[model samples]
Target: MDFQKRHALIKEWMREAASMILASFQEELTVEVKTHRNDLVTNMDKAIELFLIKKIQQSFPSERIMGEEGFGNQFQDLKGTVWILDPIDGTLNFVKQKRNFAIMLAVYHDGIGQMGYIYDVIEKELYWGMKDQGAFCNEEKLPVVEDVSLKEGLVAINSGMFATNRYHTTEMGLASSGVRMVGSAGIETVHVASGRLAAYLSYSLCPWDIAAGKVIAEEVGLVYKKLNGEAVDLLNNNGIIVATPKAYQEILTEYLLKK
Candidate 1:
């Protein structure tokens, strides 16, 4: 499928998207609530989604796209080439901090992830992975992360879930060295892939939230799975855990599943 060619084009598009996002900081953002007060969608989010979708259509008109801004196709199955996008993964962070957010995109062929990208706009760091080609941050190739046990390393968990002790998340945090809440699934997933954190857990995350991160993280030998240790369903939202292999097994066996 000429993955190298596509990868080159995708990287170019991500750079363009990053430029657009950075430019928006100069102008006043038009923000609105999505499902709730904290769930935000800015004008830049819709603009970036539309912009990337346009670029993809120009090059790969036959492929289907699913975007968080609802500018792309809506379908029930992943039968053909499909692109998933999250224009601004941490919209609240972008609005409040103007940093720590990322743009995430992923491509799948017949439901198998072919490539993924996570672009940290402020940092200008692009994390990407291609099937069997390995994962990288900028020009540096990422290596397989150590299989650190849960008790030995820090963990990241959804803030609300940890505070509420949902699914015994607080206990899981206590079992680890510490807990962090990055507020962005894309960034947290990258942290795990780069060995910055031992594990990442979220009570609920949409397909776009974890799609790109899953591809990139899994390529670095980390495990991506549902809380119950099932494979993620790319078409639906699910409780997720991305971690080093040993941390994954320990998190499930000792914390999440224990009665």
Candidate 2:
């Protein structure tokens, strides 16, 4: 399919998926904890995943899917078109605050990202990108990331970064103008995409947590790198950071790697 045709279909799928999510929001959702209290699941997540899977199967049957909730296909290779989906990227925030959660999707062809979406359901905000088409927030397009000093930048990192001995995020925090942890990678990605923060640091994240956001950020001229200052693999989970080029250079050179 042409890029325009595919995108129109994708947007339609996203809208249908969004309506399902809104319907779920109005009821008393059944909730379950996954690995810990901080990791959560809800009926909404499952239902939304199912809704998306059905659409993909009916509309694009050949595509493989990797979904957070196991409602989509499980594939070992990315040789063909693949969809990476997170029905609700911040289940904990969804269960607790009923906001800060997002439905994210990314489409890859032979391991290259072709299109991506991040939908903030409560705020009705959507960020989307097509590899060369640039990134959009609602109807407003995002501009390229800018160069700035650490003192002029605010980063969104995981709160655990400060609480743990890992990566010296506490020291990084000390050097930057400030730090904020919103507990959701999707939300953090939104901030970085819009230049609300120059960077976002997360030590542990799956593909679903960062795939769509990575594409959008990259389209808007930000760098999506592994915490070690390497290019991010769209298919793997790792220590990931999204940042403006200058802030990223500074963080890697000055603040990281402390034991």
Candidate 3:
């Protein structure tokens, strides 16, 4: 199959899905809890995911989907063509700001990310990538990451990751040039992909949260790994470090060490 051609089709569908999200932005959104009070789901989230599912089924009937809204299947492994999707990556932001939330999706074949797309629904900006074509923001080609030391670079992490015990990420990220709390994994990942931040650290995030961004990062020569230098596991939720090669290495060595 032509990965490039599939990417083009995904992008168009992604944009259409994004537009549907915008139409319901300001209205009162129904919120529900999943595992905990902190874990939230909005009506828009389900709507968008369902819309994408219908679109994907109509357009790519053979592809399997694994999505956050539970509209897709629960899979053990991603083989053949798999689409990973997050209808609304930042449900809180969509509820509050009606912006900053994004629609993230990835298409993988044979366990490799073939295409990725992240649409910042509010700004109408789309960040997309393919296996070797590199990443793009809107129509502009994204510049490959420039090497930067972790100490002199910025890191984005939500409050939850910093509060955890599995890694010394809190100290490491603080020691960097600065730290940003975006509350949205998809947004932070886009920042890392587009070179706004040197890295993005998040612990135990769903596939929909980072699948698309992983493709974008890889295309730009970034290393998308775990906190302790393990490879990113596509099938599980875990801490992730999306960084330029140099920054990723620095993080593994100089930081994330037990005190």
TM-scores for all candidates? 0.98, 0.95, 0.94
Whichever of 1 and 2 has more TM-score, that candidate is 1
Which pairs of residues have clashing backbones in candidate 2? none
Instruction: Compare the candidates by TM-score and give the number of the best one.
Output: 1
Please say which candidate is ahead in TM-score: 2 or 3: 2
lDDT tens readout by residue for model 3, 1-259: 7876676777888888877777775577789988887688988889889988998898889889999988998899888999999999988777766778889999889789888888888788899898888899998999888878787789887678676734677678767898888788888888888778898887778878878999988998889987778877788887788988888887777776454
Of models 1 and 2, which has the larger lDDT? Answer: 1
Clashes of 2: 0
Candidate 1: global Cα-lDDT?
A: 0.93
Show how many residue pairs clash in every candidate, following the order shown. Answer: 0, 0, 2
Q: Please provide the root mean square deviation of candidate 1 (C-alpha atoms, Å).
A: 0.8
**Candidate 2, residue 165: CA error in Å?**
4.5
Per-candidate local distance difference test: 0.93, 0.84, 0.83
Tens-place lDDT per residue, model 1, 105-189, is 9999998998999999999989999888889999999998988999888999999889899778888888899998989999999
Which one wins on lDDT? 1
Please give the distance, in angstroms, between residue 132's alpha carbon in candidate 1 and its true position after superposition: 1.4
Deviation from native of the Cα of residue 142 in model 3, angstroms: 0.7
Candidate 3 local Cα displacement, residue 156, angstroms: 0.5
